[model samples]
Every structure is written in structure tokens, then in C-alpha cells.
Target chain A: MSKQSLGSLLIGMLIGVAVGVYLGWVQFPVEYTNSSMQALAPRYQDEYTVMVSEGFLVDRDINAALQRLAVLGKENTPDYVQDLTERYISQSNFPAIPSMVALSEAMGRLTPLMEVYRLPPAPTPTPFPAQ
Target chain B: MARSPRARNGIRWLALLIGLVLGIGAGLLYTWEIDPVIELNTAPWQLNPAARENYVIAIALSYARNQDLTLAFDRLRAVAPDRNVWQLVADIACERHRSIQIASNSDIIVMRALEQLYRSQGATGCADGQYPTPAPIVFMTPTPTSTPIVPVGPQATKTPTPDLPTPTVPPPVATTPPTSDRFILARVQSFCDAQLDGVIEVRVFDARGQGLRGVPVQISWGGGQREQFYTGLKPGREPGYADFLMERGRSYQVSVPGLVSEPRSIEAIPCEAQRDGQTVTVTTSYWINFQQQAN
Candidate 1:
């Protein structure tokens, strides 16, 4: 119970706290092995959205595409698709633009800017006249 | 010996050690519990099971559209750095099949996409061939032509001409060939390997000699013991490659369902082979090859 011992204890405690903080935040930060889709980083989220959009192109099922996109925990799935489609349009991500536009159009989120990117309608047969 | 009084006042090392331990515990508690590291910039490998499944589904569907195997492999590698990506996809497909997740058309497409991705990569599972891929849709547009001008001459067609039936375009049909008894055994070669014992390796190929995936292979032994397996189960092997092990001194027949040729019978006879720089006795192994017959 000497003052010197107490002083030493306090100093040691302060140094330990600093070391602990450093280890916790810098050296060995907590790693997450199980994160939901919503926890994905912004870039990855955008990539996932593009993938889903591409899937929509393959399946052409708007409802299913919406259900898949819902896992991102977006407030409004249609608006999110619309915004992303427009953003891609603005950014000229051409490879992803058509699918995203198709998905947006399916979700009723197609904007004026997305009109040019809409998938061209299937060609129809031209009737022949009697020879 | 006379010593200085200052030497008698030694440091309380035990107390300081105790204080350091207590402080470390407190600090860890504050950092891990009170305000932990923010969840940001998580990689695909960190995704939970459900999220990972979704991510995999997206990848498969994307691959289906793009047919970019390299891109798909790269993306899947990011998701599973340590494991075989094709097998991962096959497991997901099997899980989906077991869960009856094909209630909707989209779900069925997802299953097909997963199968297409894995089977092409020579990975198979229980869900193999559970959902057949739909044939691609092709539109046959007729070329437009100008109307022929008919003169209004009274003598040309005074009598009413018989009405001609209008020609109609046939409905679009699936382009995939029928899956009947179209496969015939091409070659059956027996070999003995120390590493592979009493194994019947089956390889099924298309008419063009290209490997086919998802074809079921059946093996039957005494006592009516029968087992069915599909090709492409081993990612390290060819897509049409599958294998079965036979016990020594036993006879087995290998056949593909709906196969036109007779099933091949073989005996697992004993043989000598090299093993780890030493001679060892092993059972004979056979390789069965089946090729699709020309239509």
C-alpha cells in the first residue's frame, strides 16, 4: 500500500490500456465471417445489382428479379434499380446498361435516359404478297 | 554488509502485473463490446450462408448470359478462395433441389443456371439433371414482299375463284434433340493401377466426341444391388467422366440408362501393380466409354 507501488501500478495500467487499444483497433481488428448481403460494400453492392440485372435479362421475370434485389435491404427496390440504371447510363457502363435498363423497364422504373438502352423488340415476319 | 536504505524499497512487481492484466481486460472489454469495429468493406467470402447462396446464384446466371467462364471463375474464387468453386456451385444446386426451391419458373431457371455452370466445369451432385435446360428461342421472320398488281380485266376472272387456305407459320419448338436410347457404348478398356483399385471409370461423350455432362450411369452387382450416378461429379476429371468401385472377385455390369448397346460386364480380378516404390496386389480396373449415336 505504498505510494510508489500505487504509482507503478497506475503507470503499468495506463501502458496496458494503450497497448490493448492498439491491438484491438489496429493489429487484430475483429473480422466478420458471416455478413448479410446488405453489409456488402458499395462497389460490391453495385456489382451484385448488375448481376441481378443480368439475371433478369436471362429469366425475364421482373418479380423474381425484385425478390432477389430485396436482399440488398434497399428502401425501394424499383427506385433503386432505376437510380442504378440511370447512374450506369451516366457512367456509360455499356455492358451492364442494357440489362439494367431492361430490369428497370420491367419494374416500371424506366426513365427517359434509359429509352435508348432498352432491348430492341423482337423482329416480326413481313407478310409476302401472292406472286 | 551495510546497504543503502533505498535498496530495501523494491518495486511491487506483482501489483503492477496485476494492474496491467486488469487494464488489458478492461480495454478489451471496451473495444470489443462497447464500440466494436464498424462492419464495412466485407469481402464476398465473409457473406453468410444465405447471402453467399444468392451471390452464387447471381454468378451462375451471369455466366449463363455471358458465357464468360474466366470471369465467372474469378468471381467465384473471390467468394470461395480455398475450395473448388464448381463443387461449391453443385452443392448449392443440390441444396436447392433438396429444399424444393423450384416452385417458380425463375427458381427453375436458377437451378438450370447452377447446373449449367457446375456441369460445364465437371462438378456434379444429387441435383444433376433434375431440371432440364430449356431450348433457346429462335424467331423465324418472313421477308416482306411487294403486293402483285392484278389487272381488273372482266374476262380474266369472271368466275369466282375457289378460296385458297391461308398459310400459317408453324409454332416454335425446342431445338434440343430427343433424349431416348441415343447412346451406344463405344469402347471398354481394362487397366490396373495401384492408385485406383477395382474402379469402373465411365466416360460419356456426344456424337462429336465432346464430353457430355449430367448423364446418369448405373451399375448393378449380385443380389440385385444397384446404384445410379451421374457424370461430371469430379471437377478434376472430364465432364463426361464418372467412376464406381467394385469389390475384388465380384462381377458388375455397367450401363447408361436408355443405352442402345448391351450393358458391359466385367470382373474385378486381382492384379499386381506398383505402389510407393513397392510392388503390391490390386484389383483390376476398367474404363467404359459411351458415345451418343448419330441421329
Candidate 2:
């Protein structure tokens, strides 16, 4: 091959590579269909935590709530619930405050901020005087 | 030897095409395998099968507490927009039971929550009625049977008064009788809607008009057919609400425990209703309410 032909081929290959890269990365990027809960965005993660807290209110089972929150792949589930509850309090997310506080109390993560939102205990009859 | 112009042109074109193909392959390899899109901001639908199940379970549980079907539907739509959301819940429940995932109490509750969400929406699966929701715990207040017995003690100083003070008897303490659990058929109303067809919605309430949960509601139909379902199963509605779909041309009877009135009967007769500016034929639906009799 002559020097001119070689130069032309090299230039063509370089241009082709640039087009290909543009098409591959920009025009059509890979889309993930299968992902773990840990991949959830920050907003969704907070929503899931609140849902688990509500479930805790329904069943009053801390272990179950902890297990459900485990899917988030957090290192410490209780601390996560606590921190989220505290965050909600600071942000004044009123709709979720009660359930989150109840779950935090169940997990022994209740902070002073959550204390006001604690659900009142069921009433019990007073004991009669000893005969 | 000197190459022909045409042959040289062909060779140039071939080299360019080869270069393009090679470049495209390399680009795809890098993008797909080496540095694919970063995993972030994944929507609920993109979740893996296990994660999707978890997401659905959370949605069901949230619905159970919040009793907001619209919100629940919106959330489930986020998970799978193209499919039937209620059927999706049913499938999840069936899968859990099939996979032996009901070993724990929470697992069982998860199954129940799933069933409640699906079944109440007219979706049925193998897990239907598999995990019956236990009745809510009832704590009775302790009632004193007899007055406390006070023993007579020797007086520190015995002074015999001419007339001993009349033995005083504590005035009789009036006690109200405990309320009976008897329930009576309070009202039965029939209505037809193009959206909701052939449904028998049963509601039970205490004497105070508050909805009561966990009351067994029994339904009987043709040929002595009978089925029992408990309230509060579908927490998405009122705690005392439970409903059943009725077959066309069938008469159904509903009764609750301690019901004073005879079992209420409803017929699924064809009715006319309007929908989207068009008239449609739909089966009749009834809402029967039971109230505790105040004693």
C-alpha cells in the first residue's frame, strides 16, 4: 500500500471510532432492569423505611420490621430507622411521624424529638384495693 | 505492476468499511461490558425479582395501615404499570406460599396483607384463604364480684356508749350491666355502579357506631354454599368492612355472630347504569350493615 492510502485508512478509522463511541454512550446507554434495593435512590429509600415503620405499627413486630428494612442492605438497620425518624422529625414530615416514632421506640431508637409523637398506651383498669 | 484505478477504489472502500465495523464493535464492548451505565436512581419497576417482591410487600402493608387504595394503586403502578396491580399482588402471595416463605409470623402477616390487597380487589390465586387473619385480641376489664370484707378490730379504748352508733351500711353501689355482644341487622341498601358490580359489602359496628374488626361474617348461597371471612382483613377499607362478589341470578344470605335479626338476603339482579355517557347493564350490589344492640 502507498503512504497516502495508509494515511487515509488511519483517518477514516479514527473518525469511525468517534462516531461509534458517541452512539454507544450517548444515544443509547445501558438500562438496568434488575437491581437490588440498595440501588434505590435516596427518596425511595426513605419511603421504604417509612413503609416498614408503618408495618411495624400494624404487627408490632420489631424483628419483622428489622428484617424488612434489611433489604436496603444497610449495615445497621436500627440505626438507619433511628436516623430516618430523626430526619423526618427535623423535616416535620407529620404524616409519617407517628409510625416512625412507634417503630423507633420498638427498636429502642426513640430520641427526645420522637418522644412527643409516641402513641399513647391502651388504657387498663385500675386494680381494686386488696381485700 | 500498476493497480487499476477501479481496483484501487474498491480496496479503499473495503478498508473504510472494515474500519467502521471494528470501531463499532469496540465501542459496544466498552459501553456494554466495561463501563455500563452507573446503577443509580433505579425505579421500583427496575428492581430484581426479590427486591420487587419486597417492594410489593411494603406497598401492601402500607395500604393496610393507610387504607388509601388510590395511593396504593399509584405506588403499585410504579412497580408494574403495564400489568394488573391486584393480580401482581396475588401472584406475589402465591409465590410466597409456594416457596415456603411463611415460616415466620411476619411472613404469614405478609401473606395475609398480600391476600387482603388482592382479594378485596377481585383478584384470586392459589394463596387465597391460605393464611387466615387471626382475630384481634380482646382484653376484658376485670369486674368486682362482691364487696370487700372488712374485719372488725378491737378499739384502742373501749367506751360503751349508752346507744351504739347504728351499724352503718355502705349505700348500695349501683353497677351498670355489661353490654351484650349481640348484633342486629341495622340496614340493607342496594345500589348499582358500572364500576362496582355484584358486590355484597358487609359492615359491623359496635353500639357506639364505631366499626368493629375481626367479626366473622358468614355468607350462604345456592345449594347450601357457605364461606366465612373476617373483617379487618382488608385494612385498606374500614376495619369492619368485608365484601364478596355475587354471581348473577344468585341470592345470598349474610349473618354475623349474635345477630338478632334473621339473616339478610340479597339478589344479584341485572340493573341498568350509566358509564362514560353510555348506558350499561350491571348486576346489582348491596351494602348490609350490622350494629350491636345497646342493652
Best by TM-score: 1
Judged by lDDT, which candidate is best? Answer: 1
The whole-model C-alpha lDDT of candidate 1 against the native structure comes to 0.84
RMSD of each: 12.1, 11.3
B92-177 per-residue lDDT for model 1 (tens digits): 99999998888998999899889877765456799988887555466556789999999776666468879999899778665556
Clashing pairs in 2: none
State TM-scores per candidate: 0.65, 0.61
Top of the candidates by DockQ = 1
DockQ of 2: 0.47
TM-score of chain B of each: 0.51, 0.47
- lDDT values of the candidates? 0.84, 0.82
Residue B182: error of model 2 in Å? 22
Where model 1 places Cα greater than 4 Å from the true spot, the runs are A122-131, B1-12, B134-295
Tens-place lDDT per residue, model 2, B1-295, is 8876634743566556667777777777777788876778899989999999999999988876875556778889989988988899999999989989888777877887788677655567899778876544555556969988878787678668797689997675435434678987765779899998899888886653456899999999999999999987885887778899999999999999899788867889999999999999999998787777657
